[model samples]
Target: MIYVNEAADPRLDDFRDLTTADRRPDRPGGRGLVIAEGTVVVRRLLASPYRPLAVLGVRRRVEELADDLAELTVPAYVTSSEVMAAVVGFHLNRGVLAVADRVPPPTVESVVADARVLAVLEGVGDHENLGSLFRNAAAFGVDGVLLGPGCADPLYRRSVRVSMGNVLRVPFTALPDWPRALLGLRRRGFTVAALTPRPDAVDLRRLPDGATGRVAVLLGSEGHGLSEQAIAAAELAVRIPMAPGVDSLNVATAAAVAFYELTALAHPGHPAIATPRPRQRTDGGTVGQ
Candidate 1:
């Protein structure tokens, strides 16, 4: 571990002014680095495909991650909480941070080639909602996520934290050409179903028996719901039955309900959705990410 007494040290540049660092194009040093906060997320970053660049933390937080960092050659800067706060420009209760370079995302065909279930998104620009959707997808055994136009960057700092780092684990790729590319999923035998609140839409719980096999769930932003073109492109439209006064659920909550229902129908008795014991980490701590 390297001891850094000063906050302005040149080596700590990556963690400097993090509050404004992630704004794309509008801010200086907004180069889009993959940053993980706290020991849980930092450990997840260490295990992810992204190459770790450096880590900055208080001594106690650094010590807690010793097992995970033992084999890594990345620099671990040790400092007091005051110094860290100065560098990051805020009081970060998470205590530790790790940064990694962004890597090229996988192509749409590659992410979908061997998938049985997928979540396709359109105009989901809210980072927290997008992250929560990924967490739900991971929980229910979604094979991959295909991003249509206007989705937020899943690797954004807030997204990574809100997802509990599940975004790092789930495979996602961008789908170019909007609703037109949805035809590719049809050609590959996926029953693309759009989730909407239309009165005439098929009730989600009563999805037809023919809706089995490979399936793709199309979700849109919470505000406008799906576009007319997107709804028309899908083979079927499905809706979650709700109380009379309720118009719609939050997008992420709606996704969780849909994910559970669809996964139960698609892969009955699948281990992913079954009750399980707490995950044990090799380092003896319970795994949270």
Candidate 2:
């Protein structure tokens, strides 16, 4: 561990002025760095395929990650909280931060090759909503995510933080040619089911038996929903039933509901959707399994 007394130290450049545009990897003049905040997210970054360049935190937070750091040869910068705040351009309550270079993303074919359930997104420009969708995908065991078009970069800093770092865990790839690209998924035996709120759409709970086979749930931005062409390209359209006054749900919430339903359908008896077994006493002990 290196104790740096000055915030101006050259080694701390990767973490300097994080809020500025130049540090935003998704924008022009950006370094394209993958940053992880807090001990939990930092630990996840360390475990991810991305190679850690450096770690900066106060002494206590640094000590908390001692074991994770021990396995790495990267520099761990231990500094005072005041210095850390000054270096990062804000008071980061998470205390610890790690930055790594972005790695090449997997191709659509690779991510879909062996997947059973997938989440396909279009025009989901909001980073927070995209992040929450990724978190939900991870929660429900979604095999992968396919970005159809106009989706935000899942590795953006806000997305990484909002997702509680699940973005690092879930595999994702970009789909080419917009709605037309969906045909590739179909050829691979995936039934592309688009989620929409149209009255004529099939109820989400009553999905056809064929939907239980390798399925891809196509979701769109909440404001406009899926484009007509996108919906028409899908094998079927499904909707979550709501009250008369409610017309739609936030994109992330809607994605979560769809993911749960589709994943449960695809993998019956999964822990998340399975009914809990009643406990009964056996000859030697209580049993539930």
Largest TM-score belongs to which candidate? 2
What lDDT tens digits, residue by residue, belong to model 1 across residues 154-209? Answer: 98889999988888888998999889988889888999999999999999978998
List model 2 lDDT by residue over 1-289, tens digit each.
Answer: 9999999999998888877623565644464588899999999999998899999999999999999999799899999999999998999999999998788889887899889899999999998999999999998889999997889988888899998898999999888898898887888889899999999999998888889879999999988999999998899999999888886999889888998788877777677663434555766565766
Instruction: Tell me the whole-model lDDT of each prediction, alpha carbons only.
Output: 0.88, 0.88
Deviation in angstroms for 173 in model 2? 1.2
Clash pairs detected, candidate 1: none
Q: What is the TM-score (0 to 1) of candidate 2?
A: 0.91
Instruction: Count clashing residue pairs in model 1.
Output: 0
